[model samples]
Target: MEAEFKDAEIFKRMMDATGNLMSDVSIDFNEEGFAIKAMDPANIAMVLFEAKNSIFSSFNIEKPIKISVSLDDLNGILKLVKKDDKLKISDSKNKLVLDIRGKTKQHFTIPLIDENYTAQKIPQLKFTAEVTVLSSLVKDSVKAAALVDDSIYFTVDMPRLIISSKSEEKEFSQDLSINDNKEIFDMKSESTTRSKYSIEYLTKFLYSADSEKPIKLSFSNNYPLKLDYEINSDAKMSFILANRLE
Candidate 1:
């Protein structure tokens, strides 16, 4: 298997996002693209990541392969990538080879993990509400809620999506509506729905998000929250956080 990316930025960002929850991942490379589905140790959250072969500058794979690798080691090597640096990846026996090319050339090899990982199945959740809004709005709401409470509430009331949190006397709330806020691109709900989620998880999930792009959120009352972040047309990430019981 051999693949070359024009830049390592997206790969680095992906590792950064998933590393918050998992120490390692088993990535599946096929003729179509690459995919990974992993759940955090606590089992409170799951991350689904996919990148199409089209996203790579060059991609070649004779047969399907699943390689498990330590995120720490991979992230360490990716950190060395300078701006606009190209990354070449290949596998040799039990080792994964990474080549960085920019002002200078560098090569690093890390052993592939020998452990086996069962692919996580994504939950088929029926959400009553769905909203699409600028990532910056979600980031700001999470940040504000973090300052006051450990858990945040997402309430869908008609055309408005309300994010709020409360800790004793301290509280934070941000109201976003498709009719009033340009940041809220769309909102739909069959009925009023509200769900609470961990602020810590939400914060980490949005940490690497592109604030300029819109994020899709889906949830039902007391149901898990699914947040979808699109890096591009070919690269996308989806995070699911179990609702915190009141």
Candidate 2:
């Protein structure tokens, strides 16, 4: 498959979402769009990447393809790309070729071999409430929870959302109002459902919050928390983080 992006920087930003979570990733390119899915090392979390059409700034896919490679290696390869460089990826003789062209032209080769990687199956989640909040605020709440405990509690009400964490040492809580046009949009809470989640996993999951858009959250009592961020018309990325209830 042959694909090109106007600038390599955009591609770099997209790949950063994976971080060091998965050693192998499956990239699916089809007439619909480009999609990727991988589970974190511990299988407690998942990262999904997708981009469609011009929504990628510049994108073109000649044919459909699927390839698996180490996420860390792919990230290292993208680091070599410079600004304003056009990126071209192609599969040749079981190897992936990465070409970058702009003020400087560079080409790198990554050997591809079959690996025993099973794609993660996303489960159907029946969430009690769905809340839309500012990505920055969510990130800040997770940061605060980090200082108090490993697990953070999320509780939602109709007009307000609360995030709190407490330990033998101290407690931290942040309240956000839905009346103001701050970040929260519509919140529906039932029976005051609350769950605790690992702060470390939650922090890594918010790495893509720089988009300035609201992050959609869905949770149920004692179930996994779903965090979704839409990139554009083409695709939406989501994470399923398991909860650690107290």
Candidate 3:
């Protein structure tokens, strides 16, 4: 099978995001697109990523295939790809050939791993509150929490959407208008809803939020949080992070 991509940056961003969570990954490539669902080693967070055929400028598939690859190895090969390079991927019996073409063509072959792990099942969750906030705001809040501790708490106090973190030395809180759905967020929470999560996972998750589009977060009291953002046309990413309970 062969697949060509005009935009490697999107794939790069996605691979980077997935690599932060797991060293190896299974990418199921169908005629429509590629789908991935994986849980971190600690099982505290799950990632679901999909990119449709329409998202690619050019797509040619001989057949549907499940390709398992080492993210570390893929990253090494991707480091050599230039900004305007067009990427082509061809599959052999046990190797995936990656070629980047621009001024000159660079070819790198990666050995595909055997598909041995079972796929993860995404669960249906009912959340009491959901909010869409600016990606920058989320980054700022996470950074603030990083300064204090490794964990942060998110709470919905009606109009105020709050994020707080405390350490041995200091505590930080950021409050944004939940009513301003256009900018801050659109939220629904009657009670003082709260959930705590690890800042480490959050920081890696937010690393993929390079766009200005608002990030959607949904959760309930002490329940797992679901976060989602659009990567581009026909491509989107969603994450479920288990809440930290004391």
Worst 10 residues of 2 by lDDT: 53-62
Worst 10 residues of 1 by lDDT: 114-123
Tell me how far the alpha carbon of residue 80 in candidate 1 is from the true structure, in angstroms, after superposition: 1.0
Candidates sorted on lDDT, descending = 1, 3, 2
**Per-residue alpha-carbon lDDT of candidate 2 for residues 1-246, written as tens digits (9 for 90 to 100):** 667765566567667777745566677877666777777879799777777755444445567788766667788989977766678887787888888787887888887758565766777789987898888888888888889988898987667788999999899998877887467867887767777898888887788556477898899887889998875545577888888857
lDDT of 1 by residue, 164-209 (tens): 9999989899887779899998899999999999999998899889
Model 3: which residue pairs collide?
Answer: none
TM-score of each: 0.97, 0.90, 0.93
Best by lDDT: 1
Checking candidate 1 for backbone clashes, the offending pairs are none
Task: Give lDDT tens digits, candidate 3, residues 168-200.
Answer: 899999877755545675777768789999999
Candidate 1, lDDT over the whole model: 0.91
Give residue 129's lDDT in candidate 2 (0 to 100): 72
Candidate 2 at 81: error in angstroms? Answer: 2.4
Candidate 3 regions with alpha-carbon error over 4 angstroms = 179-182
What Cα-based lDDT does every candidate model obtain? 0.91, 0.77, 0.86
Worst 10 residues of 3 by lDDT: 177-186
